[model samples]
Target: MNGAQDLGGMMGFGPVVPEPETLRFHADWEKRALAVTLAAGAMGVWNIDTMRHTRESLPPAEYLSASYYEIWAKALANQLLADGLVSREELREGHAQEPPRPVPRVLQAADVAKTLAAGTQYERAAEAPAAFARGATVRTKVFHPTHHTRLPRYARGKRGVVEAVRGVFVFPDTNAHRQGEHPQWLYTVRFTGPELWGEGADPGLTVSIDAWESYLEAA
Candidate 1:
């Protein structure tokens, strides 16, 4: 595990490095809690470790306001609710008499993993909606949808050149299910802060974001 110490002296926020005794203390505390929680069959107590965007993706207000654990907790709760493992009411109740319900038989982990491994799975079927090609001058669309999207706010509507032609990956725009896994040409779009924020931005700073084909258009 690349725990806290590994993140020291990075660009912005650094990692939390716990001392040896502190780590032992937390581990023992968590072990006891896990035993009790599991014995009680508490719903969704186990934290899910998944990749969220880089800290740079967070809005300035949220970035400073939230703690690392707070962010992780919110994400865990969101997944449980979204997956129907627990209802809003159940969430408020905190401890459930029952274990968190497993996902439906049709979408169980083993089955989903098998499908993914075998290369047959639900995927977005859209093709080529992007108007620009790699190496083309283009602008990121200023999109502010009601749901989750990978289009970072800082880079929106900014002009940048496509740096690379990375092949497609999951489209997080529609939903967390990776609603669209269909292949669309992807690009490493690089924008200078001066270009994105105009005169207020640091002239030498630049940010690169991986933008899907759908989020881009001709400049």
Candidate 2:
């Protein structure tokens, strides 16, 4: 799923310009987009990983040109369409052309505060002992999966040391594909900048990534 969105270590994008003041959104539509996405998500048709995969799966050109909330809006639309909740004609006309499908849960306005406070947790009970421990050296498996994966492209096949065991968590690769949580141990792996980038990368610079057990092998 290599796309324009995975520009972590790539060059030519120019330095990131941070806003002086943090704003929830830059436009009114952006607020509405977030609201719609949250509301749709409350229905439980898809999980958070699926939502992310939908956004990341957009065409490279479209993904690059789209603003942040625009991607969310597009992804939400795609999810709704894929789940048979809405039709293409209905999306164009901005009105329902058929009966609405029943959902398991609905997010009421009164419950918004409680729902926001109790965020969904991905952490789960460990099913087995961790394969690697802190200070253990490991190598990431080089992979290019067609489905959703949290492992970034730059870190693939790179060697790093386990810094900490973050405990077992729901594996997003399977969760996104409706293949169950398939919980696995997660760890913070530290890698030198040169290992991920090239020889020209700063020798003093180091990066840490929370990698899933499935992505790593003992080195």
Candidate 3:
């Protein structure tokens, strides 16, 4: 989906600035927000892709104005309400109004470390041979769907060379909509800056993106 979150080459946003890696949370509430988001995610009701879709699906105005964790918190609240785990009154009251709900798994305090260390795996066994090989030229298919997609808007309809075979992995487009994983071969596609940004871009500049097989076709 083309959301405000997909601001790549768009102008008027100002130049990108690098942030120091030393800083983690800017506020106490941010820490709590991350914990709550992770805890709710442990319910197994939705995957990461779905959570991202929900977050990015926020109204353009709302999505653009909110902060990072604000988006996460809002999206989580919406997901909770949509899943029937909480009611509007409960959310307003800040207390449970209905009986307890069952989840597939619970994240215990002791298991937090183990769970964090063992991240969920997205890679899946391939059912077919890779469609494109390293160094092969391919063009990205140009179409917009009203669902979650890993391919960015700026990169669509562009031609690039396969840089590496990243193995088969769960495709986010279908998985984000609860349609199924439908895993596909993954590849690192490298595009020249001039090809993507026109001749005005720096000739030596290049960008690489992890693209799924479905997003590319033989050039």
Candidate 4:
């Protein structure tokens, strides 16, 4: 038969199914962990990008392996353990423990109003001219980075058009890498299937993706 059938025949044990209660509990835990992990991950990334302190004192593994919410929970737990806010035993035993520091009070209405009036806030605005106006041609750079990059591999070296100037945004690719967060003008680049995938592409379909102006070069 197939490779899977051959393997299964060799291994006498079947795929074991958990009891309904156990399965339900695992599912619930997974959901909770996912929510926490994502929040924690965002916070960790934002903290580093913004040059602010992060509660995540642990390595990247805590964020990568945990569920979205669980990542945050793990990071929080790690922070607590590191700062002596909670002990490792407490975490392992799942016990409620004191925070390392006291929670601060929320800002009052007047304070918020004053802060808003001062204009010491951050707002993302587009900063680039739509060099290639609507329907004008452009091409994404064929960039290869040894580390991480925001450009998806599929879009590299593909020809696209300036569909719409989407205004300025904080370029995560730069800021996340500790480069800088200078405003980068954004645009929606549209591509026909043939331009991206060659003759194998379906003629009727098109793909649109949001890309920063800096990511494109003249076709």
Per TM-score, the best of the predicted structures is 2
Evaluation by lDDT, superior candidate among 1 and 3: 3
**Residues 5-35, candidate 3, lDDT per residue (tens digit)?**
8878878866668789998988999999999
TM-score of each: 0.57, 0.97, 0.96, 0.55
Model 3 misplaced stretches (Cα beyond 4 Å): 15-20
> Which candidate achieves the best lDDT against the true structure?
3
Tens digit of per-residue lDDT, candidate 1, span 82-149: 55566777768876745656533333444545644665232345465555667788888886664555
Candidate 2 lDDT at 70 equals 95
As for lDDT, the candidate ahead, 1 or 2, is 2
RMSD of each: 8.5, 1.0, 1.2, 10.6
- How would you encode candidate 4's per-residue C-alpha lDDT over 1-219 as one tens digit per residue? 011111111344457666666544355767776544433433333333322122222344443344434544555566545545469877888876654444233345456566446643233754546566777788998776533345666677889888897777766556744677766777789988888777677999888878877788888
Q: lDDT per model, in order? A: 0.57, 0.92, 0.93, 0.58
**Each prediction's number of clashing residue pairs:** 0, 0, 0, 16
Off by over 4 Å in 1: 1-64, 87-95, 99-131, 175-182
Higher-TM-score candidate among 1 and 3? Answer: 3
Q: Which residue pairs in candidate 3 collide?
A: none
**Angstrom error at residue 116, model 3:** 0.6
